[model samples]
Target chain A: MATLNLSAVTKSFGATTVLHGIDLNVADGEMIVIVGASGCGKSTLLRIVAGLETPTTGHVAIGGREVTRLEPADRDIAMVFQNYALYPHMTVAQNMAYGLKIRGTPKEEIARRVDETAGLLGIGPLLGRKPRELSGGQRQRVAMGRAIIREPKLFLFDEPLSNLDAKLRVQMRGEIRRLQQRLGVTSLYVTHDQVEAMTLGDRLVVMHRGRAAQVASPMEVWARPADTYVAGFIGSPAMNLLAGTLAEDGAAVQLRAGPLLRFTDGPRAGGEGRPLTIGIRPEHMLRDGDAIVTVALDLVEPLGSETVLHGTLASGEVLTARLPGMVPAVGSNMPLAIPAEALHVFDAETGRRLDA
Target chain B: MQDAVLARQAMARQRRGRWLAHAALALGVLIFAFPIWITLVGSTHDAATIGRGDVPLLPGGHGLENFSTALGEGGGRMHTTPAAGMLLNSAIMALLIAGGKIAISLLSAYAVVFFRFPLRMAAFWTIFITLMLPVEVRIIPTYQVIVNLDLFNSFTGLTLPLIASATATLLFRQFFLTIPDEYVEAAQLDGAGPLRFFRDILLPLSVTNIAAMGVILFIYGWNQYLWPLLIINDRSMETIVVGLAKMIGSGDTQNEWNTIMATAVLAMTPPVLVVVLLQRWFIKGLTETEK
Candidate 1:
């Protein structure tokens, strides 16, 4: 097990910066999932840790040893690529045994370790089969088994589940989580899928434009996003954001679309009449709750267990609410209520969360 | 009833098309095969019959006599080096040229594609420029160098100059570029240093390209005419192609036409056999390596 630390890691391609200075300390055996849209530099950060790419300026320390200049093999780490880059020519067993063989491990030891890892990955019957002969999931397992057989201090995964089908993705996600825990190896996984981030990461690093938007536990990031980007990115159907101004007493918001929603959680620090951005989750919109707003229903999406209602406000701004069942018919300007205490308050100019 | 009539009409049209296609195909095959057929038939006649300018269409009674004379007793009336020995020499030259070109080109292409050093592009372009100068163009200079090095009549002189192949190197370099960057990173993480990676992964994956290139280079080396003729003045050091060409020297009246035709057949057989035997791998290598 290893405790990994990155100190102000910054990377740039010529003049365009890809990863702004990022500082993070991953606890021993903790799985940190870096979640972001494409070009957000999550994959670059993982590559930097893998020694595939060097940060323009920063330090990477693994288990108290600086490996910023070491080669990938010398860094005591293993990485699974997005495409599952198993050698197409080698059989599954040879693919897994390659690292040990390169290190001059004894033949019997290499065979034993490969057999054990193949059994662990449930690919024992595939030892003689080439990668092209195996199914996609089987190839992914061989890739993982190839990494696991190395037994390195760190495990790096780059969107490993993206090639699998949805059900297979969920299955492999649980398998990865359990395997990480059982081996207790510090791991860093990067994916653009937010659900994978929430379910797999002990802690999530939500990145925006080149910076880590929020680095916290999944629940904390879900509950208290640091900025507007994190606020909308980490939730399903996204958290609804409305433009408004604070009432003179600072206890309620005067929405641009004409509604006064009180802040039952108490007044936040902001000048009276100052413009603000109000945040609330789609699932938090209730049928008849403490605070209410009028929405002209446009469409209803019944997702089996829940229904998502899409509507527009009087100001022509779109709004969505997730409720337990179907709501009223389309084109109706009906009032959807929400708990006053559930509102997230952010400043209009900076997009930073204003309420603690 | 109308649809049935239409279907019958279409079937008749298809039958007509098939007849035309078969006739065209047979004509095409005949155009290509007639020369080889003449060569085969001419190799079976007596020297006097062929010398009279009447090309034979069928095998004559002297077929075994002509082949045995060309193979064991040498095609030329007074020459001591048999066609069989010359054919063996050609085999050695072709195999060595093909094998050496592949090994050297693979190593050079690997170095140029995988490693970074000074003048890499310059080196690549220099190798590429060699394509413009075939051995015939630089015969005098190459011959002088070979004479100076005392390799004038050896297999080294026959194959070494011809083995510096730009097409094979460029083909290999292009193929190497198609290897995904991820495999290199994976090999690096697997602790496979450069040479080990080249041997264990890159080499095996390149088997198709190697086989394809081998077929091309073998035919090229086997068919070399002027370079082998210039360097190997000794009849014992002659290749089948060069020796056969010498057997028909100056005019048809003085040459042993039947034995010369038999030697030409011997010269062409090995290369055609090589292509036919490796055709499957050659096509697959050309088409499917990236997959």
Candidate 2:
């Protein structure tokens, strides 16, 4: 197993920069997932680490050996592509043995490794079948087997489960996490799916527009995002954001949202009279007449376990609330409570966390 | 009574249509087969008898006699037989040319399709330009080059000038373009070098195109006339087509129609057999037209 490190890595396709300078250190045998939206260069960063792409600047070191200029095969890293990229002409066993064969491994040893990996992947019965005969999930297992037989220092996965159906994707995600844990291999995974990143990552690197927005554990990123972008992007149904200002009211600080509601809590220091964006998660908002703000329900989506209510606060800003049970019918006016502790405050102009 | 009459009339018309279609098809088949039948029938008669146009359409019971005479088995003073030597020469030349053309075209196509190099587009256009310039147009200069290389009257001389046809290169290039780039990338990741990739991946996947091109190149080499006639003067080195010309040029005293026809049939056998055997691949290769 190896610890991978990217030091000040940058990439560009001509004048258009895809990855700004990125620095990250992944601990040995740790699973680090890089998540971002499309055009965010998360996949490019993964490719750079896998040695399939060359960074325009900086260095890539794996297991303390610099491999920025090395070929993928020479770097001794195995990548499971999003498309699987299995050799369609070869049977499953041959596909798994290809890397070993190319390295001039003995026939018996190659067969033994391939057999063991196939067994581990639960694909032993599919040894003689070609990739075309295998289903998407089966092909994914063979691809992983191909990489595992090499027993490389590190494993790189570029959205490996994205091609499967929703249910299969979930199943494969569990399988991959289980395999990675069992093998105890250092792995770098890239995905745009927040749920996958949250569940699979030991450390999550949230990227936006080619730069790391926040690098933290999943729960830490959820609870304390670095910026308004992280707060909105990291959560399902997204975090509710409203423009307001913090005002000093004697011993407590009140977040005044126009003339309709005022949220008071800790004492204000320099935040008074400054424009700020107040953030709240859907699950954090509750319906209580005792709270400061009142809202008119615009829509309700009952998802069996939880109902998401879409409505506008009295300040004319939209907000969503996830209630424990089915919410009232659409267009029902209700008073909503904003618990002071669940509130996230960000600088309205800069979008940076105000408390950071 | 009126309905029955109409049904009977329709049945009659349908029968007539089928009869007319069969009649036309028979006429077309006869048009194609008549000359070959005439040639076979004429081969059983003496030259004078064939020239008189009075030879019976059926075999005259002189088939073996005519063949023996044509094959130089008659021991006649005027008899000339070079059929065996001509067939051997044609086979050797065709085999060399077909093999060389396939090797050259496959390598060039693979390189053009898979690699990045300076002057790649220039090389592709150069090969494409040759398609417009027929072999007959370049025969003089090509012949001079062969003569300068001391390859005159050699089998290598006969086959080397025809090795760089643009059709085979273009065909193979188009075929190779259909192969997914992922396959090459996968092989590269697996640590395969260029030669290994070509042999294990590219070549195996191109069997249909190779078979199709091989049949075409074999036929072109087999039926070559003008160039071989100009370059090869030795009787022992003459190909079947050139040897046929030589036989036909001789006076009637030495010319035997039956032997000539037998030799002609033998000379045409290999190409016809190849086309028959690889017809499926030939059609498939042409029909795909993949870019």
Candidate 3:
């Protein structure tokens, strides 16, 4: 149980810089998930914390001890890899006991801990089996058991549940969240999946191109993304971003798709005719007779509880709407209103949020 | 009715092809086994019968006598050592060479694959390039080095020069590369240093490769004739292959063909036993490198 701090951590491979100075502070016993697309340096930041990779220039401290230059073993950290990375030649018990055995724990004590950890993981019957004999889910449990038996101050997970099927990923996600809370170990988890980030972390660090775009609670990030990149990344069906310009003295935005949507919160501090990007989430698009914009449907996906309509506006911009229950069939025009409170305005050129 | 006729034709054609394949394989087996059969038959015969150019195709009644004489006195030749002593020497040399080569190759391969140091690739290429210079190619320089070291007529001289095998090292290097990098990271987190990793993880994983390489290197050591002939002048240090060659003595005197044949059979037995014992593991190691 330790607080982790990474200050201005940067990494580069030869000429290409991967992580461009990321700084984050994780509270003790809190799980902070770093989520991003591939090649976005989330894994690199986690590895830097793990002492598996050295940052080009930065410092990492765990429990008030500087571990930037320490080896992973000396850093008092355990990592669960995506592939489980269980030593195939070892039985499950041996895998779980390996760290303690290497630390010269007594044989009896090692046995006792292996039994205890196996019981905790519900893998007692599997302790005698080799990794190859276990299913994918079983191997995942053993990997977690191996990390847990060490009782390290910090835990690092590199997309640990990404290898499982969808149903198992969900199940293991819940289990990992419960286990991390119960163990109360400070953890840094990296994943490309937004759902995992949303459900697993106490706070989420939505990364874009190596920098932390937003670091906040998941719901906070969802409701108020920091920029256009994060606004598009964290939600399913993605928030619809339309190109527009500030009009009526920055109190409203004039859409190229022939609608004037006013900012409800307050007037953004931008000059008139300033280019802007307006964001509206799919679930927030409401059906109204006198709507702001009209969409001619091209694709309609109907679930039992909701319908996702993919269409294009008359002014030639694609929009998706997730409405409750089924809507009309494809090729019909659906006039949807964008609620004023749901508007997310950003600078068109810089992609930064335009806050009032 | 037409479909049944076509099926019958197909079955008959398959049977014919099988027969043809079996015939070809039988011919190959005969071609390979003929010399060995002749040696077996010749060992059972009297020397006088073979000397008269009337070597029999079938076995003779003097098989036990010939074997005992070959084992006890080694054909009464002047330079030839007894079969038992030569067998012991050959066994020791083969076991040492195989074990030493495996040990050295495994360590070198582990170093090249796992560690990052200055000139690592240079070291690997240096080891790899030695494969081009086999013992037969650089035998004279090797002999001079052994002689200068004063290792003449010693088992150390006979086996040590043959111990560092480039092929085995390369094979192990390729095998080690197939191991995932995650295992190394996982082991690092487990607090295992290089030596512990090698002992706990690498050595156990390489059991099949060791068995396979053991079979190959044992045969290579057992069949060595030129190196042993160059270094060993003492009768006690003579290996079986060299002893067998010396038993004939340049075709000058009436040789004890029966004894020589019996010794040849005895010389082949140990290598064959090693291969037979480890055949299953050898095949598995060669074909399947996956975890």
Candidate 4:
């Protein structure tokens, strides 16, 4: 087990800087997931930690030892690539035994470890089969087995479940989490899938552009996003953001969509008449008779037990709401009540959260 | 009724196409096999009969005698080497050239594709440009170098000058480019050094390509006539193709035509055996590159 520390890690390609000064400390046996949309440099950050790519300026310390300039093998880490990257000519057993063999492990010890690891992965019957002969999930397991056999201090996963089908992705996701926890190895996972990040990470780093916008627990990121980007990115159906202005001496917001909702938690720091962007989740839109704003329904998606409503405001701002039970028809005006306690307040210009 | 008629018409067209294909293939086989068939029949006849131009259409009882004489002893009235010695020389030269070409080309191709040293592309283009210069274009300069090195009348002289194959190197480089970058990264993460990765991963993956190139290079080496004839004046060092050419005298009547045919037949055997033994791997290697 190990703790990973990155201090002011930055990466650049020519003038195009990919990662801008990311600092994170992962506790022993903690799994820190770096999640972002493509080109946001999540993969580059994981590669930096794995020693696959060096940071432009930073230090990477694993288990209190500096390994910023070391080779990938010398860093005592293992990586599972997106495509599994098993040697095509080697059998599953040989693929798992390769790292140990390179380190001059004894023949019998190598064979014993290979068998044990294969059994743990439930791939004992597939020991003699080559990579092409295995299914996608089987290949993914073999890739993990290859990494696990090394028993390194760190595990780096770069979208390892991407190649598997949906059901298998979920199954392997749980399996990886269980294996990481059981092994208690400090791990860093990189994925663009928000669900994988939420389910897998002990803590999440939501990256935007080239910077880590927020680093917190998944639920904290969901409940209190640090900026408009994290607020919108972390949840399904995406949190709704509306243009507004601070009014009534920091106690209320006057939405551009014609709703003046007061903050129930506390007064925000912004003074009256200051521009702001009000945030609300799709599921938080209430269908009460006391309507604050009305939306003209454009499309109604009934998803069995619940329905997702897509509509437009009088100001031509698009809005989405997830409501329980089925809505009967489309192309009608629907009134939604905004709960004061559920609203998130951010500065209109900077998109930073305005604390009470 | 219309669908049935259309189906019958398609069947008739397919049958006609099959007939044309078979006729074309039969003509090609006959065109290639006629001379070899004549040589086989002539080897079974007396030398006087063949020399008189009354070439036999079928084998006679003298086949074993002619083959034994051609193999064990030199053809009468010709200063050519024995068929057995020429066949041995050809075998050694062919094996050496094929092995040397493959080893050197694999290393060169690996270097060009994997390593990122300065002027790597320049080095690759230099090798590529030599494909335009065949043996006849650079023969004199190559011969001068061989003479300077005092490698005349040796297998080294025969094979070494011809071993650096640009075509084989290009083929290997193309195949190496198709290998995904993940394999290299994975090997590095597995703690294998560069040479270890080459031996453990790259070489095994290149088995089929090597087999296909081996067939082509071996045939090219076996059929070498111009270079061997130019360099080797010693009869004992002569290859089969060169020795076979020397077996024919300017005066046709003085030549032992039956023994010459037998030596020709013996000269064709090793390359045929090589193709037959490696035909499956050669075809697979050329057709499919995927793992």
Candidate 5:
């Protein structure tokens, strides 16, 4: 296991910059998931760390050794590609043993390791089959097995489950997490799917426009995102953002969305008469009469375990409330409540969290 | 009843179309086969019998005499005419040229497709430009270069100049381009260097292209005439094409139609065998390329 550190890493293709200065320090044996939207350079960052792509500026160190100029083979790292880039000509066993064979490992030892890794992956019976003979999930497992057999210092997964179907993606995600835990190898995973980042990361790095927005544990990022982008990108169904102005009333500061629903979060010294965006997660909103404003329902989506109610406030601002059960139907009026502490205040112009 | 009649009319039209297609194909095959048939029949007739212009509609029983005369039965008369050495010389030169061309094309194509260096694009275009320039245009200059290298009238002169054909390089480059980049990336991650990557991954994947190019190169080298004739002036160094020329050059009164036809038949053997043997890969190469 090794810790990967990137210091002031920047990448540019011709004149267009893909990655701005990125600084991240992954702890030894830590599984850090880098989450971002497409073109956010998450995959490029992983490739840079894997030594597949060289940074236009800055350095990459694995286990305290600078490897910015090293080729991928010299980096002592293994990566599982999204397409499961297994050699089409090789059997499952040969695919797993390929790295060792290239390294000049003994044939018997290669076979033994292949058998052992295949057994661990529960693909022991498929040793002689080529990659085309295996299903999508099986090919994914083989790709993982190939990496595990190498026992490299770091494991890089570039959206490994993105090609699989939803059910298979979930299953393979669990399998990967379990395997990583069992081996305790340092890992870096890049994905656009926030759920994979949330569930798989020991620490999550939320990237925006090629810069790291926040780097913390999954819960920390969920509860306290660094900015409006991180807050909106991290959670499912997304957080609801309403544009308003922060107004001072006595000793408390209140957010006025449209003079109907007001959110007061203690007293603020500087945020007065300034444009602000108030953020609240859908799960945090409740269907209670204790709220400051009553809302009229516009749509309801029942998702078995939890129901999502989409409605408009008296101010005509759209809001969503994820409730525990089926709530009011469309066109019905209901009162909505949000805890005062759950409100996330952000600068309207900058999109930076005001309370952060 | 009206619908049935219309259906029947359509069926009859389809049958007529099929008959016309068969007829066209038969006429095309006959046009192609007529020359070979004439050559075979001509080989069995005595010179006087052929000159009489009443060539038989069946075998004339002069096949053995023509075969023996072409195989050197005429002693000093036909035996020392370079026809016999032409077969062995052409076989050696064609095999060497085919082997060298395949080797060079594969190496050049792999380097062009997989590696990056300065002037790579220039080199690719330079080689590709030669495809548009026929060998006939460069025969004199190529002959001078070969002679300057002291390869004149030698096997090296005959084979080396024809070793670097653009057709093979183009075919191989297109084939290599179809292989996904993932394989190269995967091999790189597995500790394979460029040489090993080319050998283990790219070469194995390009078997069909190599075989197809090898067949084409063999035929092109085997059928070469003007350059080999211009370069190799020695009687012993003459290829089958040059040898066929000498047969037509001997005094018209002494012309041996039977032996000339026998030599023609022998000359066609190598290219025909090459195509027949590698037809499977040739067909696969053509079909796979369309995808």
Candidate 6:
């Protein structure tokens, strides 16, 4: 219902900086997901926004009200933790009612909201049962219901679906997305799973170490990752990054493995013989194209409809190609084509994108 | 014929082993129960019968008379009030001790585990060190403090010093540490400040431990003799345990053995009842296993 702004929010635990001056502006009713590997400080940034953690510097504002120093309850935000964190002794209804009850809502209002939320979550039958009696998925729903009943200005989810089994996790992920859309509440969800990030967020913040590496829509981040780190992080079979150099005319990159890959996206700000790291996604490695790259086969994975091939380049780096169905078992020298537009180039040393 | 004979011999040996095990178990049970059985029989008899050194093995005709007298007139010691007063005093003391210790310990433990305050560990260790110095170790100084405060012969003197031990606090601290950090965060988001969290979440979750600790502290408070003996001199304020011991009266030769035995039986009943009554909750282990 309201915009959230984090202006240079930094957090440090003792001497170790966990989140380094993170700045994000989430539009009203937008669900922005922060995704990263473990220790990347995505969770810390989320916590700082939640008011469970205090940022070492900068400000957090929700609905135009500065809440950097406010308590989570005072910040008007609800968070669903990874463990659900339902009060174990309380029944599902009581768990949902706790926040409103604490806020001194009228008895009937609290009861009505709790009942309505339970029904929305399809957990009405579980109202009287304590959290201990509920299944894992059921507990997760109750945890969500606990947050939704508050009807807070914003919702924060810290990998809420991580605890469920893979199948359940997918189901819950879709449900969470659906609920958030239906409610149209501003939400920030943090997770390490790229698929969840891609599917759930209006925009994805791909974090690396203590900083946001790339913040863009899912498809934008996929098609044009801001850096080599994000490119490697987003795809299923990660983008194959090879050490290459700009061609003498600056129109293409010459691979150390002796393949001349042309650039079709745009001309980059790099000179001839400029050392660069060139990336090509697995799915975009085409079998029919004008540009050809010869590779030595290392391994192959047959995943039903499509077969993914892993090959060793001449420079002794791994290259992957995802091609559709029944690839004839090619010998040592496997000839493959990579379309030019799918190529991503970054400065070799800094790892920053050169195709800006 | 030889095979059949061997099988029969083996069966006989197994029977003998079973008989021996049962006999040993019965002997162990008897050894533990003998004193209680004798006390029960002794409590039922007249003073003349027990005083002649012929303790009866069965209930005597004086059972009702002995109980009624004990209940109505106490042990007949000088200025001795009825067993009812002493029983009430004991009940008050025990409940207060258990309840006071639990309340204090729970609060202190919550503070130590959840909050980050200056000198927190110092306070915890200070409390923890009290475990080394039980009331029995520092009785005289404690007694002096009670006397200086004009708390003598009062319930305050009897229960206050006993409540200062750190076992309950340390026990609760350990239990509090096992609670997940997420719950604390969840409560904070739920707008429950420390006190509310303590009342609603921590206390309810600790029901079994509190019950278990209650059983222990009640017995500890009930069986107290030395501390109460030194503090309360008023016959009206006497606990049943201490009063039962007082009936022997500093080498009084005319002590009524039947009344004393009846009072001993009375002293044993409340603590046994408390344990029996709270036993269900006492045995339910900590952690709801719901997660």
lDDT of 3 at A167: 98
| DockQ comparison, 4 vs 5, better candidate | 4
Give every candidate's TM-score on chain A: 0.98, 0.95, 0.98, 0.98, 0.95, 0.97
lDDT of 1 by residue, B1-291 (tens): 999999999999999999999999999999999999888888888888988889888888887888899999887555456899999999999999999999999999999999889999999999999999989899899999999999989998888999886888999999999999899999999989999999998999999999999999999999888899899998888999888877766743467778878887888899999999999999988998844
Write down the TM-score of every candidate. Answer: 0.96, 0.87, 0.98, 0.96, 0.92, 0.94
TM-score of chain B of each: 0.94, 0.88, 0.95, 0.94, 0.91, 0.91
Off by over 4 Å in 5: A249-265, A292-300, A309-318, A327-336, B44-48, B55-65, B68-84, B289-291
Q: Which has the greatest TM-score?
A: 3
- Which residue pairs clash in candidate 5? none
Clash number for candidate 5: 0
Clashes of 3: 0
DockQ of each: 0.76, 0.35, 0.79, 0.73, 0.43, 0.71
Off by over 4 Å in 4: A289-291, B1-11, B76-79, B251-253
Q: What TM-score does prediction 2 earn?
A: 0.87
Q: Find the 10 residues in a row with the least total lDDT in model 4 chain A.
A: A286-295
Model 2 chain B weakest 10-residue run by lDDT: B72-81
Q: Report the candidate with higher TM-score, 2 versus 6.
A: 6
**lDDT minimum window of 10 residues, candidate 5 chain A:** A250-259
Binned by DockQ into CAPRI classes (incorrect, acceptable, medium, high), candidate 6 is medium
Q: What is the fraction of true interface contacts found in candidate 3?
A: 0.79
Q: Native-vs-model 6 lDDT?
A: 0.90
Chain B only: TM-score of model 4: 0.94
The weakest ten consecutive residues by lDDT in model 6 chain A span: A326-335
Tens-digit lDDT track of model 3 for B147-181: 99999999888888788669999999999999998
Give the lDDT of residue B263 in candidate 1. Answer: 80
